[model samples]
Target: MRAVLNKIRPKEKEEVASDLKDVFDNFSEDDTINKAKEKLEKFIAKWSDKYLKLSNCFNEVIVEYYFTYIKFSCNIRRMIYTTNSIENLNKKIRKATKNKQSFEKSSRLLDFLFVIIKDFELANTDEISSTCFLFLGGLRHNYRHGPLQEQQS
Candidate 1:
């Protein structure tokens, strides 16, 4: 989405992002996996010509292994598809580590970093019970398929 948005004029980017958000917002309203898949396909088709990056990204999000490999739970969380958690983790670790002048040893640095990670984990505890995939709200676990692996380019 960011890739496609970067192509737009700066003046129209915010409005376009908001429009895209509306389309994504509909996912939570869908009551079943098929309905959510339908919405995703519709969204891909609607933006395929205009935003190839978004089309590919959404396609990647829906796959046989993705549904099969992840042990999803009812405790769904919003914006799970975004890289916010991973990025936030990086930022928090950097900020926490930067406070120290230097580590006496690598083990000490590792221990400090571990504490930072644990603190972040405790803060975002939703990740422990949240669905591994987006649009998984109220979705059934009937999509089990093949083993998990990296998506081929």
Candidate 2:
């Protein structure tokens, strides 16, 4: 979508971009699939007059899959809608493999990817570790105190 947006003439880019952003802002506020579709339809009607190509692109391509997000929670919807996390991971993978022309086998490529993913996981383990400790402590406290209260009663 950003690629398509970039194709707009420089003179019209800012206005069109701002309009599109406003449409997305409205769409994101919708808690239901039906409301989201309504918002999109309204945006298409409003913007089509000014940016026919951009509006048509959304109507023809993007709206087709818009309902798929309805089953997901808002947090997941936000994550899926944004490209930052996946883009960052892709950037890291591209940088790591940029110098290599080709892998000897598919397994070799998979091995490299596995190592990269494992390294990222290990780098992020501190937060996970602390959460795990807090969870385990709560469980231990409950187990120790729960039986004692039951026996006294």
Candidate 3:
């Protein structure tokens, strides 16, 4: 939304921002999945006649990804779409591997990555929930260390 607002002229930015808030009033984060699409459709229709581009963009990109968080339980909604931490971890992996050039074999790469990523995981485990730690696919936690809850099969 900040990106959208940045495109507006400063003189009218606030007014346009308020108008865009109507999009949220129509279908905010707290909405349930069943009603989300309907409200989104209504918001699109409300603007389609007046602002074709805005509505089209909203429908095509924004509304299309709208169900992303609504599909998850609200407890984990904030964690669903974020990539900053993942990107940071990726940066670390890249930095660690950059000087190595190449691994001798596939297993060598896996072993090297396991150590680096495991270090990153341990570094992050305390900063975030163990449940969200599940984000690190296949980086399983030992039960003795305390899982927020048991992993489901």
Candidate 4:
């Protein structure tokens, strides 16, 4: 695994470093700028090597072993490194579920979450598709299209 990671390490470092540089260059300097630059440089230095390893592992296991072997490629995102979007979504869901102390079952919780997600998705489907793949995963899993699964009297 390490050998595999080492192979693609340089490309990954370059990509991450370039991306960090772009983001860092956007901010203007005060004390915050220096702090952000320092943090970002350190992060790029540390994770760039590891990110390739992680990606390679995923490629090897999920893509090669599972997807290729099975001949089915899923649309799952490789990295979910960013979290602010989900924190905000959870805040919204928490507000909605504040009144309910206990969910009767996991499915009930899922149903509630689905409603919240579907309503949000109706407004900004594109942004939701791009930024929040996991949210899309949950939505896809929970979605019931066509006629209702259960017949109504």
Which regions of candidate 1 are displaced past 4 Å? 7-16, 26-33, 44-71, 98-110, 121-153
Instruction: Tell me each candidate's RMSD, in Å, in order.
Output: 12.8, 12.2, 6.9, 13.3
lDDT of 1 by residue, 1-153 (tens): 576577667886886677666544432333444544565577567756765566555555553332321223323424344567778878987888786899766545555655565566667786633232222233322223422233355
Model 4 TM-score, all chains together = 0.37
Clashing residue pairs in candidate 2 are: none
Instruction: At residue 102, give the lDDT of candidate 2.
Output: 92
Rank by lDDT (best first): 3, 2, 1, 4
Candidate 4 lDDT (Cα, whole model)? 0.48
Q: How well is each residue in 1-153 modelled by candidate 2, as lDDT tens digits?
A: 575476578887787678666555422444676666776777667656766675556654566575565556654565556666557656777999999999876646655665554454466553222222222223222222222222232
The window of 10 residues in a row where model 2 has the poorest summed lDDT is: 127-136
lDDT of each: 0.54, 0.56, 0.61, 0.48
Q: lDDT by residue for model 4 over 1-153, one digit each (tens)?
A: 234335445757566556544533322323243354455456446665655444333332332332221121223221122345567667877899999898766656766777776666665564444335354353344455521133245
| lDDT of candidate 1 at residue 11, scale 0 to 100 | 83
Q: Candidate 1, after superposition: displacement of residue 37 in Å?
A: 3.2
- Model 4 residue-pair collision total: 0
After best superposition, candidate 1 residue 106: deviation in angstroms?
Answer: 7.0
TM-score to true structure, per model: 0.45, 0.52, 0.58, 0.37
Winner by TM-score: 3
Identify the candidate with maximal lDDT: 3
